[model samples]
Target: MNYNIVMGTDNKTLNPLVQQIYQKIYPNIFKGSKDIVTELFLAVSYDINEPPVIDLSQSVQLKKEDFQSYYTSELSEEELFLDVQEEALILNMLSKATFQACFPNINLKLKLKDTSLLNINIKVSAKVNIQTSIEGKQNYLSATILTADLEIKDAEDYKKYIDELKKYILPLLIHVLNKDLLDKIKLPALTFKDVTVSLPIPVVEKSFVTAYSCIGARQPDTYTSLNWPAETVFAGIDSHAIETMAAIPFPLKKEKEFSWKIISGHVLAQVFNPRAFVIQADGSIEGKIDAELLAQLTLKKGFFKISFGPHGKATIKATFKPVVHNGRLLLTVKDLNIPKLDIDFGIAKWAEYLLKPLSFGLSLALNEIFLPLVSAILRQIEIPIMHFPTISFEIKGITFNIDIIEAKTSKLENQLLISGIPSVR
Candidate 1:
């Protein structure tokens, strides 16, 4: 009955996911800065795992100093998440650039003899400055590399190469970060894991209503007989309560009854039916009765009445239509048919007259039972979760209404898929 909203990165868990992204971007980084290797005419092979491990730890927290906007106080959590910090973004961008420039044209085999081949190692670190502006709902992110240092191993004059590449590669790196990467960056939505909610059983106590009359009453001559027998005739019953069930064509059983008096006899009719049903997308329910007749009734007056007429068996088929009340979907019994009705005894014929009413009552009761149950189940449920790519930080829950971002659902052979994109604010 309660909701919790949590937003933060699990840095330890995200390490592997982040590594995968680096692996994907590694080849492209080398390709973009390939000139760095071609200029020195040095052929060398490198592994992506080597040197300059990226630090994404800073992306988890938001600092007011990180945003260069005067409206920083006005930003909500969602906006802060969307507006990625400029320093962290720039540092990560420069890391990729430095990585590509330092390790280039890897996997090269050298075949020079006697001349000791100089082995050189390179490591890079940087200082970055950024400016952010918001003009008419458009956010602009740009950065300048204040200083970039390249540490070299086994080479005394490597500083010159470091200074040269700094001028060439830093500008290109910053340009791509602002124009390509950050330009497309968006705030992520929140998502939830599967949630289960318990539902209450849907049913009303014995509340069926019916009317009866004295049809087969034994007549006494004058005032001679004081105990006159009367076979209570149940003319009709309110099936509206049962009609409610036609919407959910599922099989359900309940203790049902109608109370009435016939002349001098008190008649109690107990109706019971057990049915199973399935619901289709178009709001139609199709189901068949498990036993003869939609239900059987026991009529009694101090043990003098009968328990279901003899040979009263029927193959009843039922259908239900769906309706939406408030914010929930509920079912109503639309139609009931007795394609096969078997009346074995003469007394059983009387029960057949009340079959339609009986069916309607059952349907109505079913509808009442399931309407709120279905609604509650849907309201308390949680949808499939979504997270930021690779970093594994969740962005938002799956939603249909299109706002700044929205998610769409697709069904595919026992699977549900939700995909979406965030729109600009």
Candidate 2:
């Protein structure tokens, strides 16, 4: 396959994205001043029927420029698309300073030649400044010459002038745009550096575009492979890729209400030990920890507090169901049990009578106190995603955060699919 990573965005998403871009970059849209000339003002109006289109490009070409196809095909291929709220655009300037221009109506379009040659077609309304030379035998009735402006008299001349503009505007605009905006327009929508995936080069289609790349292979690879240029606007990854997740633990915490007297329990400590998140199709993660947790028994006499306590160490085996809440990773301990437990507290033959009852009490603590307390602490525990947020791209010196919608194993694919959309921080 030419590509394994496929992503796309359609028109329904494009319209608002254009408007959103307009709001952000509007203030800085060609914002600069020369003491030679300053105070420039620009106002653009758009019709509901048409809106702007944006792409991931370092250089933008004028609509009327000659077509140069990057990947041409004898048979037509579907175009790539990403509808974003806003994007940076470049424009040329000759002189500014007390200058004002209002484009009454603007319609922008993306046209593709062959497989992926693209040019942005912009149609803007401009009122032409024309001086009239025609004079009627003005007041000829009185032999007095005068000049009068009539509508239809200059109609043909006006058409010719506007038609000539299309030819003149493109070459001039493109030259200036390419020279000034190459490094300034940062498109962060497709940057996935943290995931180690390169943004796919976009291909032009009829009205949409799709970006595809055979970039990086997922570790602990997934099944049900997809054809390049798939319909989903998403990133597919392996669960094993999140190295930090392995540090997360399902531990029994000490709480005054239920666990003040309990021995400590912590799993998957990063300094010495780490674990992997093994995702199952049902949205559960199952793993066994080899580390030990302590369970203690105590026998005390009156106020003197002479005591005997038998402490046990257990290798905790557990399964957890993780969920995201307000951008926090919270684990719900689905199951916690000890398959093996070792306990030995040497006591005199006189205290041997206390061993059986002590054993029974400890067993009761395992089911009644230990399990419930562990589960409760696990429930209250939360790993804030914002603090340890996943990084994606860096543009305009700003990093993008993954707004994950769901993290689940696709039974058919046998891979953990993290579904998300673009979000600005």
What lDDT would each prediction earn against the true structure? 0.31, 0.34
Model 2 lDDT tens row, 353-425: 7555556555554445434444455445543211113334433444344343433223224333333333444
Decoy 1 TM-score against native: 0.28
Task: State the lDDT at 216 in candidate 1.
Answer: 15
Model 1 misplaced stretches (Cα beyond 4 Å): 1-4, 33-52, 56-121, 126-149, 154-156, 174-187, 191-425
Point to the candidate with the largest lDDT. Answer: 2
Model 2: lDDT of residue 361 = 50
* Candidate 2: Cα lDDT at 198: 34
How does candidate 1 score on lDDT? Answer: 0.31
lDDT of 1 by residue, 1-425 (tens): 11111112222322433344345445544323322343443333322233223332222222343332223558765664454575566434333222111222122221113332423444554333333333333223233333444555644565544554445444444444334433332322221112211111111111111111111112111111111111110111012212322223333323333333311111111122324554444435455543322333354446455544322343456565533322122444566554333434323556555444454453344334333333333233321122222112211221222121233322222112222332211
